[model samples]
Target chain A: MVVIARSALGKLRGKYDSLSTTEKRIAQLALNSPSTVSEMTIRELASAAGASTASISRFVKRLGYANYREFTMELAHVVVVDAQEGAKLFKELGEGDSLGVIANKVFHSSMASLEATNDALSENDIARAVLKLINAGTVNFFGLGGSSIAALDGYHKFVRTSLNVAYHPDYDIQLMQAAKLTADDCAVVISHSGKNYETIQIVKELKANHVPIIGITSYSGSPLARAATVTLLSLTDEIKYRSEGMYSLISQIAILDSLFMMTVLRSSSRTQPVLMHVRDVIERTREEP
Target chain B: MVVIARSALGKLRGKYDSLSTTEKRIAQLALNSPSTVSEMTIRELASAAGASTASISRFVKRLGYANYREFTMELAHVVVVDAQEGAKLFKELGEGDSLGVIANKVFHSSMASLEATNDALSENDIARAVLKLINAGTVNFFGLGGSSIAALDGYHKFVRTSLNVAYHPDYDIQLMQAAKLTADDCAVVISHSGKNYETIQIVKELKANHVPIIGITSYSGSPLARAATVTLLSLTDEIKYRSEGMYSLISQIAILDSLFMMTVLRSSSRTQPVLMHVRDVIERTREEP
Candidate 1:
């Protein structure tokens, strides 16, 4: 049996016809109430599904899981993802809606975006991206148009860390900056659609230089994400109508914020003194005479 | 009796000692189960409190509410704000936490900040800010350090609208830009601390120019909020530790997003054509043959 890490329920349904009549009963119980089945022990599931313990063990293995425990864990993940998706607020704003209602919709939409984006993040991806950022000669942020705001935000944040960073609002300068970066440097490219012509142009330059690119984008199959050494998605529930990348801005910044926090926490020893020095300089500059 | 638009439960507690015996019963019921009291009609509340409906009406009047419905609405607001505050994820990050745990904390903290900030926004304030933005000859964005990101974002979004928006990353340039604004212009200044030295200087310049200022800050009593013609707060639940204005960034951007949405919605007829024009320009700039 091929062990696909995709949806466990999908796998069960795909191999449903292949199961024995007794195993099909167990599969029926799991499909009917996956959440309930996830909490049931192997022995309990057997009694509930009218199958023997040995049959239940064989049923899980047939579905490509190592054991009942692994099967239950994957089912639990599906439950979580489903619950998260179920809570989506894809509400549309009406012409006569009150400001309070509009504000609620806007805030809830941003929160929903943050929730969906956060759910899709993996620890290994974050760890890999942060490692590259930490070891980079210069962390160059490449973004254009709406995404430049996120890029500038990344620069504003990472500049405070021990790492050196660079960003420019002008697209020409950003392309030039990307060309200057070598393999030792890391490029953090951000785009909502993940397929802007100029953004791809800069990504091309970074790729030619063998620069390790950390792409933050909405689409996984976009040119930027495919070319990136590490890709992080910034998902949003604002698909009903395009508000010119409104909700995506919040999700993108949040992804960067997590990266910033991780970078700081992981390298606190090296970053602490530099952070303090930066704070001291700012305090002195802002102090009253 | 003074009608305090503050917490309904707080008002009930404060006036508990002064209530008549019959009124005290209603107050006790309200304090015990505020959510239940909020849902109950006047007759139900009176019956639950073992009092007459007339006495319940009198009790609400004594509490400075005009009617039973108004009193219930205030109670509902209290319930909502409490629910929002209770949902706050103020969990601290430990050194041994995994990257996934850290990302969850970061994202939840941001969502919490957005929720708290959204709860504090008033419709009247939003209407007033949008009116100012619409009527102004130019809308200039002023923010330093952390807030400049929001200001730049505001500029980025507003530029797509019909409004002549301006923002500069450089502090000196921002100050000069502030100085150039006359009474015809409107300034939207963002500062997380609400009392930054250079931000105050820019605020002072705008004041001297007699420009109407809209302040977005954490504190209502801060210099920026005090000096502005209209003050809109961007609250955060990140008070436990000094994160160098980490969570505030998300809240501020969300606030900008809300304002942008309101502006576009309110002035869609005027902004629609310009929005389409800007989109066309962007598309052409990023298009390839």
Candidate 2:
């Protein structure tokens, strides 16, 4: 695997001539815009290159990479290494900073997280997740500790739509709920670290039941990412003292927010009445002012 | 009261000659940067103008405004009406849009929300909020429906700190918790509309119990904001089709993230051990890879 040691661009150039029609289009896209391509998910790359995700997966394997994740990781490494030769990343948060400075840094980091997470999403992946959510008999949300908040948020947002959704703040109840989901249901499992023991346990249960999963996390190669039917990454520029999980929380919610919007818009007819009813109920709760 | 009909800048200038020394400094700031000053919390204005928040509050009252919130609202109104005469807001999401387009719109809206929310925050407000949290016997989080997600997130983040924190997803439990809080405790209340009956009920309970409230909401005049000891607004450029609550949620989380970052940085000595232990526990959960 000495070929792995070569630059991603160099490897692409070396393998471009021997590629198939669809694979050649993917290679052309990679060569033309390595930086943009580096940030994209496999489904996004397929859409950009007008190729099937399967073909993109096959193309990466043919390039002597283990999987699509590896190919993109190496490509991102190459692009970042090249770009950072001149460009500097963001500043680190320190103890002596004032409140205004802290607010600015947090907001900037969150904006960057949203941008990077958006860059990695594909139309196909979102469509798939929406379809699964809309057609599922029940949508169960799973997360533990810090991530349970995001799971609960996903449940809260989707409930306004026509979907039947469920979430529990308790880990034991979450595991039990995961065990109840079947192939007909969908699960949105959120974990910043992606390797949390309890979250992986729930994932295992869901997988055993053949439930489709939409994993939202920071790592691309974690167990959750590999096992998910469709994975949506929540990325951030990690810096010391600025808990990476905090920014990932913002990115994860943004991803879920996008999915919620897309689902609501795509199925407006089904969601409109539900939304109106919910709004009316909420209005009734308001004081007459 | 007819003075209210005039632009905020006009009001500021009219009252400038009558203000005391500290109040003159506040007026000068409002005149020099009406737009920026419009977005600031009173604490922020105090810090920027080198005056006490009490003086800034009294200054606004002397300017014919009933309160600080009204003063800032009028100023913001003047600034926005002038700026928006030519500049258009963002595009609204539609059913016909592709997933990628939806992702783009959502991310853009979330980013805008963060920026506006950050603009509204004053270092003084954050410092005050942080100080309240640190000194409180227990930090309680209150919200309902959509806002409960933020409340839960606040609990999750603050629990990681050294402070004692509590949150409940049930409205009844939250109300009960609010009632139990006293002047020694602090409540962080989140609501997008700030008019939700259950939230206001909880706010009433907290007020009756004499607990200091940090209100996070979109409307500056909402009951939550009016009653809060320190009001931090979460703003967004609302569009017709896009759910305004969704963007507000993003803004609320970013505000919390900033507060969380500030608390941890300011009290690193106290929180350092807890963070290290949490990190170790999470690391132990990782698979040997």
Candidate 3:
């Protein structure tokens, strides 16, 4: 069996001859103005193409899209891949953007970031990090400000593994914890910019103690990235006027998830009983009035 | 211009005659074993139907799916809506669940929870909650343990609105803050059980002070849910042996997101300038080395 690799636009062009008249018009619009077409709702596209929303839906189906949103995502993927013009598709949260647009943007951005981060990660790094974490005497999670959420999430996920995991919401407590770490410890440090002062301070202390560090940050050149033993980068589209590093949090969470799964799978013999116990406790607590 | 609203099975059955021989086989399999088909990868489906992956892809597209994933999501949606058998689709994370399966389950559950939560929320409640929050001298966020993450998230989001928001990670501080609130203030209380001892204590304080309380929890009959002036239920499927109310967190976040968006949009004239300022600060801070 052979797989045919074609761009979304190429596929549309290849299938254009068999499309219905209304579908042909929609295809022409999509191929000619992909950036504009990618942002349009089905109703908007239908009105633009002088067809009903039903016709628009059929047109996308004819072109191998299940629905309109998937068509737009493929169009955006094509635009990002072929022309390197992702800005038009990943426009920032503008003041006038509608609620539906905001919801779509945030969700799609997260999915895209996760895919990109997954692509950027190497299996070797995951294997190495899992080994280090499983064998460590303790695993300390460090983050401050916005990234603290991810740090806490990492702690929450790892706690089920029955590994000696620690995280403090207080910055000073985190610093003190970092200072006391020995070479037997492993550290997972997260900062979107990779340059938050407090995060760097914690990283410095970890480095001084020779702890193996796994860094999750968006910036490849930042201090935290430079300091870590294994650096996993989270990628996000540069959306202007949006909150700082908001999209990166999704990628960071995905990275932690992958690591957690790897650790649990690799250490199943040791971790499975603990997982069951944790589940039992959770089940009991849930039953409480 | 007439649109035919058909189940996914109906659409497939209606279009079956027009499909190629291989596509017909895939369609028959899909209509007969949707639950099994929904979980199969394209290759698996192809093998099961004695067809190529390309044929399966084309068959789903012919049936109006954007791609295989969307096709499965639609299948899951149909299974959910028709048979009311969501348990098969959202089964508990078993010990042998793969990383991909876990990720897919978690993400899809979050999306499903958001849709369910959206459907459950009353516009009147949202509008009323927004009014009280916007007019309140201070908005206190109360949660404990697992719910604290949602509380912290709510605090993080509200801080950008330049509203007088209060949240303390410490239970005592939170209780003290609750005790000090006046009738003019508002409180957003979150708990999955709705019967957590501390959360109920905080709710009692707010009730005594006549502070308008907006509650987010899974159980509508619990004390916290019964005590609040407006309750927005966060719905999740009952997955036995799963961590207690883990999926509810996503629904809670969605509720908070809706509330945040409504608050920002309704008070835009007063909040726009502050939002812009917040964006500027975030942008500058993001650029720092």
Using DockQ, give the best candidate's number.
2
In the predicted model 2, the residue pairs found to clash are: none
Worst 10 residues of 3 chain B by lDDT: B79-88
| Alpha-carbon RMSD, each predicted model | 16.2, 20.7, 11.8
Tens-digit lDDT string for candidate 2 (A9-34): 65565345457788889988886677
How much is A66 displaced in model 3, in angstroms?
Answer: 31
Q: Per-residue lDDT for A269 in model 1?
A: 92
Local error of candidate 2 at B16, Å?
64
Residue B64 of model 3: what lDDT? Answer: 86
Per residue, candidate 3 scores C-alpha lDDT tens digits across A1-289 of 1222334675564455457788789888897788678767888999999999999888788766767766776665565454532443666665586555555455455545554555445545565677789999999999887788778878887898879999998899999999999989999999988888778888999999999999988876678888999887776644443355655765676677667766776778898889879867654554334
Model 1 chain A, poorest ten-residue lDDT window? A280-289
Worst 10 residues of 2 chain B by lDDT: B80-89
Could you give candidate 1's per-residue lDDT for residues A38-153 as a string of tens digits?
Answer: 76788999999888999999889888888776677666656655654576554688657666667778888889899999999999999999999999999999889899989999
What is the lDDT for B188 in model 2? 96
Query: Docking quality tier of candidate 2?
Result: acceptable
Native-to-model Cα distance after best TM-score fit, residue A243 in candidate 1, in Å: 2.3
* DockQ-superior candidate, 1 or 2: 2
Displacement of residue B229 (Cα, Å) in model 1 is 0.9
Candidate 3 lDDT by residue in tens digits, B1-289? 9997777778888898899888888888889888678667899999999988988888888788787876765555465455433335767665576444554455455555555666677767766777888998999899887688778878877888868999998999998999999988999999988988778888888899898999999999999989998898888655543355656765676677667766777678887788778767655654334
